[model samples]
Target: MEALTLTTPALLFSAVSLILLAYTNRFLGYASLVRQLYEKLKANPDQVLLDQIMNLRKRLYLIKNMQLLGVASLMFCVLSMFLIYIEVFLPAAYAFGLGLLLLIISLLLSGWEIKISVRALDLHLNDMEHFSEDNS
Candidate 1:
């Protein structure tokens, strides 16, 4: 294995920062939707609305976890840089590897959340189709 350099861990800074930004945007969007849904549910309780809320709840959980992991990955990268700075090569390598692993896991969870989002959209489309048929 090659010796870990400070530059190696520094490389992740921009990528991870962008990812965290995206995650924050997603979280904010969900928060807005949750508020809207809450008002709707309060006005007239429906199973479809309940289901949507449940789906949102799950997505929100996933997003939270993804953000957590992403932040942890960034932390590890920083640690790796610090270790390398202190000339502890082996542990620096290990920290960098762990950071990469955490990043991969975070990305996987983001993909899973996207799948759920697509499914929710499909469900909404199905409902729209049913409503159109009834009106027709």
Candidate 2:
């Protein structure tokens, strides 16, 4: 195999940075929503609200894990670059491969989270449809 170079691992920097940025934005949005729901629950908790809260809790955990894996991916990429700088080509390649795998895992988790989000929204739409039908 050809020797690993710092540029090879550096290619991941922008992609990883963008991913982390998006994850951070998602986390912040969830945090705000949770606080709003918490206040509402404090005043008057209902079954629907309770269910939403539970859903949000699961989403938050998933986001946390996604972020964790994303950061780990970034860390490994940096480590790989450093190893390459020191002429440790074999270890650098291994580290780069691990970093890529972790990135893939993070993306998969993101996709799962999106699927759950869509399902949650579908429940709301279904409920709205039922309410309209009952009125008719």
Point to the candidate with the largest lDDT: 1
Among the numbered candidates, top TM-score falls to 1
Residue 31 Cα positional deviation in candidate 2, in Å, after optimal superposition = 0.6
| Model 2, C-alpha of 91: deviation from truth (Å) | 0.4
TM-score result, candidate 2:
0.94
Q: Which tens-of-lDDT digit does each residue in 1-136 have in candidate 1?
A: 5666788889996799899999999999999999999999999999999999999999999999999999999999999999999899899888889999999999999999999999999999999999999999
Q: Which stretches of candidate 2 lie over 4 Å from their true place?
A: none
Q: 28-76, model 2: which lDDT tens digit per residue?
A: 9989999999999999989988998889988899999999999999999
Each candidate's lDDT (Cα)?
0.95, 0.92
What's the count of clashing pairs in each model shown? 0, 0
lDDT of 1 at 125: 100
Off by over 4 Å in 1: none
